[model samples]
Target: MDSATRVQESRVFPHPINVVWNHVRPADFKFWTSAVKETQVEGGLPGEVGSQRKVTFKDGTVQRYQIVELSDLAYFITYEMIESNPPIKSSAALHTIKLRKITHDNSTLVEWESDYSSSGNETASVVEDSRLKKKEALQDLAKALGSK
Candidate 1:
């Protein structure tokens, strides 16, 4: 692969920054992302950098990731997948999430972006599939936050 393809999605949540951040934490991922059936912290503190986790999906796919960056003051977090299963295989998959406080009604704007290269030859298929999955995950997040 030449380089990793990037996919980005964003949603507005009608909740305060702190409240939205609470729901966006890795510990609460399974609640908002349907693909994430379960998650177990592998090492270190939950929200701290270098923390690792094993995420099991509903389809029985498992992926391991490490927290590469985290900033509470900036409301941002990033993860690098160190291991992955088929179809979405990647040696350097990166996921970044950013939250911006929207002054109107104390809402929040959340942006999620993922960059990865497929290990298989089906790069386009993998990218499209990931896009759809992330879209659903964001919708789920909005619903979980009680946003319309």
Candidate 2:
């Protein structure tokens, strides 16, 4: 399987690592998923690793994700859709979100990525399209978090 389509954007926020994590981690999700009427469950503990949650969209699309790595608030989370309303066939694909802290006085930079086999051409296109929307949503999230 070839690498999945990738789209990434990062922003620096003027907030502490945990503060930034607290603001961006789940709250930002609310901005993204809630807008589309999707809500993510609260399952992860602050600064702990291996925590997880599920997100369900208004259309009944669902993805189960977990925090796979952590470094004192900086971390990475991964996910693959377990179910969807239209039934995503490329269930083998994976998405990873990396969060890194910026040293310049209480700030953090975030990176979001998705990967999967090349056979998922249609899924790749859709993922590409959604990445743009994600970027827009992230921007809104930053603003809402008072990071902008």
The model with the greatest lDDT is: 1
Q: Tens digit of lDDT per residue, candidate 1, span 59-117?
A: 99888889999888999889988887643555467889899999978889989898986
Model 1 / residue 53 / CA error / Å: 1.0
User: Every model's Cα RMSD, please?
Assistant: 1.9, 3.6
Weakest lDDT window of 10 consecutive positions for candidate 1:
84-93
lDDT of each: 0.81, 0.59
TM-score of each: 0.89, 0.68
- Which runs of model 2 end up more than 4 angstroms from their true locations? 1-3, 24-28, 33-52, 58-60, 66-73, 118-120
- Show the colliding residue pairs in model 2: 4-116, 15-106
lDDT of 2 by residue, 1-148 (tens): 4445665666666665666555445522665644456555546663344555566656566656565554443466565544455555454555666677777665767776666444545765667666776687678667767755
lDDT of 1 at 24: 75
